[model samples]
Target: MPTAVYAGTPVTVTEEGFYLDPDQWREDMAPEIARDAGIDVLTDRHWQVIMHMRKEFAGKGTGPTVRALGRTSGVSIKELYLLFPKGPAKLAARIAGIPKPRGCI
Candidate 1:
């Protein structure tokens, strides 16, 4: 396990950079993490997906996959790519401070 600072708070993460403890996450950390994932800004659409990801993770114990996100996030698969780009689910999960969705890779 390793720690990185997000929004000036230290957070433990895995070797792949996924947070080790989702409970340690803070809403304020989202912007910085999203920036690191190459998203310059988190629009309302972005927050919609982020909130869905967090809710899914809290209830299911794991983040949603890209396919699942497309169906449930109210954002289309094409739009998901447009928003998160390059690995939508993985990047969104990172920004949402949840573990990478199962079966992403």
Candidate 2:
């Protein structure tokens, strides 16, 4: 385990960079995670996905996958890639302060 400062708070993280304890996450940390993931800005649409992911994670214990997100997030798959490019599910989970989707690499 390792600790890193995010949104001015020190939090534990795994070697993969996912937070060790989701309970310690703050909404303010989203921007920093987004920046690190190469997103310059988190628009309303981004917030839409991030919020949805967080909601799902709370109930499901794991976030949605790319296909699941496409079907349920009100955002299309192609747009999801454009919005959270490279790896939409992975990046969105990171920014949403949730564990990485079970099947995401």
Candidate 3:
């Protein structure tokens, strides 16, 4: 079955795209989505870090630095890099179900 639903209905498609239904997205769904995006194992700690980064971004109008994200999530910078090899803005925004970062558009 498709993961994305539209208007409270599941969408069927065979094309490659990023057409997700925000209402169908859940914090617990991040790992599978991330893995589908080529990410490896996503732990609960990863969710904590990513969600924190999202909240910080929403509150500050900007993404957090790795060091700051680490400090907030109580994880190390090295670990952050290990989890989000493409960087926080890329991985975190995707996990948070937020629009792609400004420069990415």
Candidate 4:
């Protein structure tokens, strides 16, 4: 298994670069992951999506879809795109230290 160095700690990651275990994730990993994902900084709005994704993934056993994120997360779809850029769900999931969404590539 490949591991990513986050804040100097090794974190297991899938071939696609998502975390292998959500439990292994730490809040400090977010910024490093965000930097790797090209997100300059994670704002409160970004946290809104990240928290929602983590919450929903824990309950559902998978990351949420972009549509689901748009529907329930406090942030809007357009804003999500602006915050996460090209692929909100995938990017946010990566930063949140969760697995790639079932619906994502």
Q: Which prediction has the highest TM-score against the true structure?
A: 4
TM-score list, all predictions = 0.94, 0.94, 0.60, 0.95
Q: What's model 4's TM-score?
A: 0.95
Top candidate on lDDT is 4
Candidate 2 regions off by >4 Å?
Answer: none
lDDT of 4 by residue, 1-105 (tens): 898899899989998889989998989889989998788888999999999999999999999988989999988899999999999999999999889999946
- Candidate 3 on 32-79: residue-level lDDT in tens? 657766788877877787677667766875556666676777778788
Deviating ranges (above 4 Å) for candidate 4: none
Provide the overall lDDT of each model, using Cα atoms, as 2-decimal numbers.
0.91, 0.90, 0.61, 0.91
Residue clash pairs of candidate 1: none
Tell me how far the alpha carbon of residue 19 in candidate 3 is from the true structure, in angstroms, after superposition.
8.8
What's the ranking of the predictions by lDDT, best on top?
A: 4, 1, 2, 3
Worst 10 residues of 2 by lDDT: 12-21
Order the candidates by TM-score, highest first: 4, 1, 2, 3
- lDDT, candidate 1, at 92: 91
> How well does candidate 3 score on lDDT at residue 97?
59
Deviation in angstroms for 66 in model 2?
0.3
User: What's the C-alpha lDDT at position 34 in model 4?
Assistant: 94
How many angstroms is residue 53 displaced in model 1 relative to the true structure, after the best TM-score fit?
Answer: 0.3
Tens digit per residue, CA lDDT, model 1, 1-105: 889999889999987789978898999999999887778899999999999999999999989989999999999999999999988889999988898788744
